[model samples]
Target: MLKSTMNQNKVQTLKGFRDFLPEAMAVRNYVKNLLIDTFETFGFEPIETPTLEYSSVLMGKYGDEADKLVYSFTDNGDRQIGMRYDLTVPTAKVLAMYSQTIPMPFKRYQIQPVWRAENTQKGRYREVLQCDIDTFGTNSPIADAEILAVINTVLQKLNFKTFTILINSRIVLNNILKACKITEDKNSILQSLDKFSKIGQDGVTKELIGKNIPKAKITVLFKYIKQAQPDEYLQNVINQLKILGVSKNNYQFDPTIVRGLDYYTGPIFETVVTKPK
Candidate 1:
């Protein structure tokens, strides 16, 4: 019995996670250092938050999909706690707490591992590293430009050969919905639209219909999504990034790339690796 106890079966790695062997860890550290240097060049200082947060603080910040991916539990103290799903919310909490002490227009970069109880799939994981940079106290176009510039630099510096940055605005969708007279269910509409990449147009139509959106309006929405937004809106965003010296070839205005978050009120961007290693 004592021998059996001593040899209690070795636990397996939980699904959707992995152990980073030395070879991989070395590569990861090398990339991390490069990112840290890039972040510092743009005046971003590093800050960290606890992995566990009170459920009240993180409960509803993300929409339905994210809410499902959060890992929540009751700790021994009988308090509801949740693992940090992303760096954004915890940074917001920190900013509110240190508002008096921190300088206005604070710039920060956080290179941290975030937990997500998401469906494990190729290119998706339950635990992943999120390298995020954010600025508070500014609504400046230059701020947005700087972010795009930094990301473009990071990818190039990392020796990635083929990539493009896709940018879109949630406001564009809101405007389209308003123009289509879709007043009450804008949130539901955005949520459905977010699923387009994963589920395609037919699946989004199904989701919208499930929410009881009229088929006519859904048809109009697909058309609007396919059509380019007013040329002025597209050019305006492009002009800002151009002003910051980002390569025109490296970025584009894609209307279909609505980020899957209800709280995003403005521009959203992502880097797509065309040539994955």
Candidate 2:
């Protein structure tokens, strides 16, 4: 009995990891296939990248807060390396490397596992599968609109009854902060603001105040954020979405929808399901 118990302990998976048995894997694979089909239908070809990248390549991309969650180590080669944090960075590297060969406006989808050193939570994990579709070589809001349409199609196809795709632009966010005379600590402010959904306005105020942002500036920040409207770029994206036949009910402009990722420059979006709640 003692030997059996020891063996079980040795074989157990590490914390924040999971082993999907056949029963679970069946469902997982089903969803993966569905995503692949949806992606291909939208002219997105499949691509894969390495699970490990040089430490230098991974650093300084995501903002300070998210950078801390990256899993990195010095390998036996004495070379510093990092596990994939998310699919976007690696895909960007791919585009740069093959820029000579790939045509403009390239669309690619990636489905793979990524690792991060996050505190274990109910629905969050250190190792999680990521499914992403990215369009490179385009500076058009129409491209952004296509992404929104794709999100709506994917979720609706999966039988999601009620969900909203929240969209925001860092341009508008930056403009608001600029109007507030905030420049030096913009990243910090955006990181805190990204938590608006989880933490209420009061919580965000507390966080900003803790960061030594002047109380007056905080007041101005909130005021500007409330008064801010989507710029012409975002307005064009919305108009294009309607042209693409994306239901207006599925997506809306949300000022508080600032994504936590620092690398994001233009439009950022997130989805929330409301039916099961």
Tens-place lDDT per residue, model 1, 1-277, is 8668656976568989989999999999999999999999999999999999999888799977688889999999999999999999999999989999999798999988999997788988889999999888887667777888899999999888888998887777777777788865677678777777779999999988999898998898788778857345445667888777889889877777777766788888877888665
TM-score on alpha carbons, each prediction: 0.89, 0.94
Task: Give model 1's TM-score versus the native structure.
Answer: 0.89
Return the clash pairs for model 2, or none.
Answer: none
- Expressed as tens digits, the lDDT of each residue in 1-277 for candidate 2 is 9989989788667899999999999999988898888889999999999999998889899977788899999999999999999999999899889999999899999999999899998988899999988888888988888888889998988899999998889999989888999865788898899899999789999999999999999999888888878899999999999899988898878888788787888888999999757
Clashes of each: 0, 0
What is the lDDT of every predicted structure here?
Answer: 0.84, 0.89
Runs of candidate 1 with Cα error greater than 4 angstroms are 1-8, 198-203, 206-211, 227-237
lDDT of 1 at 1: 86
What's the lDDT for residue 262 in model 2? 79
Candidate with top lDDT is 2
